[model samples]
Target: MGNYEQFHLIVKWKEQALMIESLLFLFLNIILSDKKQPVSSTPKTYIYDT
Candidate 1:
């Protein structure tokens, strides 16, 4: 078997690796990204007093 044949076999695996990387990148962003938005504090009396 030549190196290209080995490379061809590896290429299929590389696609799975690329997909995993993309999903991990997306998940990390969703979980760790500091979404730039103003946070509003709700009035304490509304819920706390009840």
Candidate 2:
């Protein structure tokens, strides 16, 4: 029972971490895409522009 509880807690922590990581990744992608526009000389470089 103790081992099971520990496993559950670890799983919960991992899920929260993954969520945070994904959010950060999305933010970075947006920032990077914006930065690329000025350097690339292309008009439609924004990925999430749909």
Candidate 3:
């Protein structure tokens, strides 16, 4: 096996690691935004002023 060559698996792992990191960042932003700001929870009636 002296002539055998080694295949690089680092590239594959690195790609996966980067993808997971981006997803985690997005998830954290979503979680934090929901806590800091709240969207409308109910519908509002429009009032017309003459």
Candidate 4:
């Protein structure tokens, strides 16, 4: 019973960690996309011109 409880706790912690990591990754992606937006548009314009 004791070992089972510990395993459950570990699983819960692992889930929380994954959630936080995904959130952080999403945040970084948003920031990066925002930064790249202007540069990315230039390529699209070029593509349209061609």
Q: Which residue pairs show collisions in model 4? A: none
Q: What's the TM for model 2? A: 0.64
| Candidate 2 Cα RMSD (Å) | 6.9
Clashing pairs in 3: none
Q: State each model's CA lDDT, in order.
A: 0.60, 0.69, 0.56, 0.66
List residue ranges in candidate 1 displaced over 4 A: 1-5, 34-50
C-alpha positional error of residue 4 in candidate 4 after TM-score superposition, expressed in Å: 0.5
Q: Tell me the lDDT of model 4 at 48.
A: 20
TM-score of 4: 0.69
Residue 20's lDDT within candidate 1 is: 81
Off by over 4 Å in 3: 1-7, 37-50
Weakest 10 consecutive residues of candidate 3 by summed lDDT: 41-50
Compare candidates 3 and 4 on lDDT and give the better one.
4
Clashes (backbone N, CA, C under 3 Å), per candidate, total: 0, 0, 0, 0
Which residue pairs clash in candidate 2?
A: none
Candidate 1, residues 14-46, lDDT tens digits: the string is 887877876776565555446843234542223
My TM-score estimates for the predictions, one after another, are: 0.51, 0.64, 0.56, 0.69
| lDDT value, candidate 1, whole model | 0.60
lDDT of 4 by residue, 6-30 (tens): 9999999988887787677667657
| lDDT winner | 2
Cα-based RMSD of the predictions, in order?
Answer: 15.2, 6.9, 16.0, 11.4
